[model samples]
Target: MNQVIHTLLNHRSIRKFTDRKLSQEQIHTIVKSAQQASTSSNVMAYSIIGVTDQNLKNELYKVSGHTHVKNNAHMLLFCGDLHRINRLANTEDNQQTIDNNLESTEQLIVATIDAALAAQNAAIAAESMGLGICYIGSLRNDIKRVNELLELPGHVIPLFGLVIGYPDHNPEIKPRLPIDSIYHENKYKPFAEQEQFIEAYDNEMRSYYGNRSSNTKLDTWTDQMIRKFSTPTRMDVTPFVKSKNLNKR
Candidate 1:
């Protein structure tokens, strides 16, 4: 495989970081790489806020409930932004035209996808530079608080945070589902041996967790999934999204 594909396949979420800080030039290049990612219809409906302030990082750490946000060399909040587009539309056309297309589920989905793609590009670039990165989805635990802290405007939502830094610890690459289970042929095919596949994967994860150097837990992938989904998570997100005038259609 080429170096790019090799880097992509060797991805891991890094939670521990060293004391080293990324230079401004590195940060600029990484963001430039993110901007180079493909966007749906070239709308590029996303924005990134790079946070290096310790106080702000502390506040965001609490909001995220993840210490990595504060510990990392840099934290980037990727946002889905329809506000810019709305303003541009208003300037070009009229308020009525903007209003007609502002609160759409399709627009929300597109912006979110755009943000995700951009963040992934950033992550890949960081990894290629021999840096580590972690995605902080827990920032969505309290979306309203994040919105307020960041002083977000309407039609903009903080999708997730990306923490980048030098690695303090090396982590095992987590296994993924078998190729056959994920990649379908001409038509979508349901797993014929679902139980068998799951059992094998669960056993593999059980070993993985048990043998891990830190926070070793006696659990399997299925066990974790059951525990996680058994309870409602981030229920406030729906109301928060509506408050931003998104996903309303």
Candidate 2:
């Protein structure tokens, strides 16, 4: 395979990073690469916040409770931001119409998807430059505090944070479900039909967890999923999103 595909396949979430920070030129390149990602109708309804201030980073670390937040050389918050375009696109003649459209659930989905696409591009760019990266989705654990810390206005919510820096240690790639289990030919494949594949994948994952270098455990993919979903997580997200005047419809 080509270099791009090779990079994509070898992707691993790097939590341990070195002290070396990314240069301004590298930051600019990564952000520019993110901007080139596809957006719905060219709305480009997203914003990237580079957390440079040490105090701000500290605040985020407190909020996220993830040691990697402060450990990384750089942190970036990718936001689903409709506020920028909403302000610019609104005129006295179209004020009500613009507000109505921006508040819809569809727009929220669009902005979230746009931000996610851009973030993936940024991740690939950083990886290509021989840097380590980790996504901090736990930022959403306290989205309101994060908003206050970031000084984010209404209609713009941080979807996730990305921490990037030089790798301190190389990690083994996590095993993924087999292609036959995930890819459907034409119609939707039911879970009942894929039970055998799931069982095989569970064995594969059990072996992976038992053999990994750090924090090794004897576990299956199904057990992990059960633990993850058994507890309701981030239940405050809906209320917070509504408070931002998004997804109200």
Candidate 3:
């Protein structure tokens, strides 16, 4: 494979990071790379908050309960933003129509997708620059607090945080599902046809869990997933999202 594919394959979720901070040049490059990601109809419905202030990072850390949020050299909160487009489009000529469109469920999905696409681009760019990165999805644990702390206006929401810095610890890359199990030829593959694949993957994951360098445990992928789904998480997210006047359709 080429260098880019090699980089992608070796990706790891880096939790511990060194004290070195990213230079302004590096940060600029990463953000620029994110902006280059494809957007829906060129709307580009996303914005990034680069938090360098120690105090602010600390607050975010409390909300996320993830040490990487505060300890990283830099943290970026990627937001789904329809507010910019809403404000720009809601002139005397089109206020009513624009307001209706922005509040639709379709628009919410569009903004979220755009933000995710951009964040992935940023992550790859950071990795390419020899930096480590971790995605902080726990930021959604207290979604309202995040919005309040960031002072995000309506039609805007913080989706997740990306922590980037030089690597302090190198962990083994987690294995993913087999291609044939997920990829379909023309029609969707039913569960009956994929049982063997799942069984094999569970065995592989059981071995991985038992032998990993840190926090080793005896567990299969299916069991872990079952435990995860059994407990409802971030239950307040739906109400919070509606409070922000998003996804209200």
Candidate 4:
């Protein structure tokens, strides 16, 4: 495989980071890479907040329910932001027109997709530069608090945060589902004897967990999913989104 493809395939989430700081040139290149990602209707409805303030990072550490944020050299918060579009539209449009755009579910989805695509691009750039990254999705665990901390305006939602720094330790690559199980031919296939595939995957995961260097556990992938999804999570997301004047439709 080529160098880019090799980097993509070897991607791993790095939590433990060293004290090495990222240079301004590196940050500029990463942001430029993110801006090059495709966007729905070319709206580019996303904003990245690069945080280095110690106090702000401490607050985010609590909000994310993860301590890694405190150690990372930098944290980038990718937000699904329609506020910029609304502000631009307000220059030549009515309040009703702006509200109509911000309240639709389609617009919300578009902005979210734009932000996620941009984030992935940034991740690839970071990894290629030999920097480590871990996506902090738990930022949504307390969405309102994050908004308050960041002083975000309406029509903007914090989707997730990315922690970037030099790696303190190398981690094993996690396993994924079989190709046939995930990739369907032309037509969509549903529930086509996945028991065997799942069982095999579970065994592979069990072995992986047992052999990993740190936080080793004797559990299968299925067990982890059950523990994760069996309990309702981020239930406040819908209400919080509505409070931000998004997804009301």
Candidate 5:
């Protein structure tokens, strides 16, 4: 197998971390690798903020349900930002502003995809260097608080946060969806075989969860499904996204 491919395939999310601090050289190299990911239109509509403050990390960790994040070496908050460009183009530069401002869904999509690609690149780079990473999607849980904390300007929004550090424990590589379930040959397909795959997956997850947990409680995937979708945890996103004074798509 290709070395890079093998490394990617063996990838797993790591939660535990050592107290070892990352060197400045390591941070620079990792971020440089991230900057190498492909970007649409070369707009590079994203920005990364490295957070080192313990109190801020703690607040964000609580919001994200990842307590260990505060203890990790540090965090990288990646944002989908069009504000910088908009301000530039709309100002003395005599540049053409993105039509409809940052409110255009296309601009937002590009920013989001760009940020995600960059983040994945960073993650791979870190993994190759024997470092651990876990993405904090919960940053969306309280976007307002996150915006206030990050001091993000209009037309800019955080896509997610990345917690990186040296590994303190080895976590198992979780199985993924079958290729058939996600890959369509020519065109898009609806949820026809979704139930079947989900059934098998639920069983598999239940078994996997049992092995990982002490036999104290039945950790079924169904329970997870119920718990996650049953609550409206992230509905504040739409309104929050609108707070950027973006054009409505």
Candidate 6:
């Protein structure tokens, strides 16, 4: 395989890490690489907070299932920061004309796409440099708590957290559906092979998670998804986000 394809095909989500810390120079390089990714309408609407403080990390760790924070070397809180535009566009003698409400259907996607692009870019850069990274969307487990802990202003909200470090263990590559199931020729179709693909993937995850079982075996991936999607453990996020004035309409 070509080296680039090789790199992509080998991708795995790494959660455990060695105790080694990422150097300040490495952090800067990764962030610079992320900034270089294309942004929507030239509006760089995202921001990142590097939390080096153990106290803050602990607080956020609780919000993020307290798993990745305790296991990873660095945790970065990426955000959809529409506040910068509003703050900068406002003047002492004038009003702010910027649309800061992410609640709006139209504006929300721009910030989300911008943030996701930046985060993915960071992930690719880290992987190429022999660093392992995992995204912790569970940070949204308590959005208000996260906002308060980060002192995030209105119009700025946490999208997720990225944990990076030297991987301590190698995990198997999580299988993906066939290319035809995902890729479109010219127009999008409701790909017909989803059920078959998902069933095969179930067997894959069953083997993936079976290694740690001592009693009942782990559910197949699809069964696990049904259970996960049926549960409501993180129910506080919607109200919390609305309280932060995000209103994600």
Residues 118-208 of candidate 5 have per-residue lDDT tens digits of 9999999888988999998988888889999989998889889999999888876776655666777787767875657767777777777
Q: lDDT for each of the candidates? A: 0.89, 0.92, 0.92, 0.91, 0.82, 0.78
Stretches off by above 4 angstroms in model 2 are none
Instruction: List clash counts for every candidate, in order.
Output: 0, 0, 0, 0, 1, 0
Of candidates 4 and 1, the better by lDDT = 4
Location of the lowest summed lDDT over 10 successive residues in candidate 5? 90-99
lDDT of 1 by residue, 1-249 (tens): 999999999999999999998999999999999999999999999999999789989988898888898999998999999888777763545766775677888888999999999999999999999999999999998888888888999999999999999999999999876666667678877667455777888898888888987888888878889999999999999999888888887
RMSD of each: 1.5, 1.1, 1.1, 1.4, 2.3, 2.9
Cα-based TM-score, every candidate: 0.95, 0.97, 0.97, 0.96, 0.91, 0.87
lDDT by residue (90-203, candidate 4, tens digit) is: 544577788887899999999999999999999999999999999999999899999999999999999999999999999999989766677778976576566677888999
Model 4: colliding residue pairs? none
Clashing residue pairs found in predicted model 1 = none
Q: Count backbone clashes in candidate 4.
A: 0
The C-alpha stretches of model 4 lying farther than 4 A from their native spots are: 90-94
What lDDT is reached at residue 70 by model 5?
86
Error of 4 at 181 (Å): 1.8
The sequence of per-residue lDDT tens digits that candidate 3 reaches over residues 1-249 is 998998899999999999998999999999999999999999999999999889989999999888999999899999999988878874777977777788789988999999999999999999999999999999999999999999999989999999999999989999888777899988999998888888989999999888989999999989989999999999998888787778887
Residue pairs in steric clash, candidate 5? 103-247
TM-score attained by model 3: 0.97
- Per residue, candidate 2 scores C-alpha lDDT tens digits across 1-249 of 999999899999999998898899999999999999999999999999999988888889998898889888888899999998778864776877888888899999999999999999999999999998999999998999998888889899989999999999988999888888899989989989888899999999999989999999989999999999999999999999988888988
lDDT of 6 at 67: 70
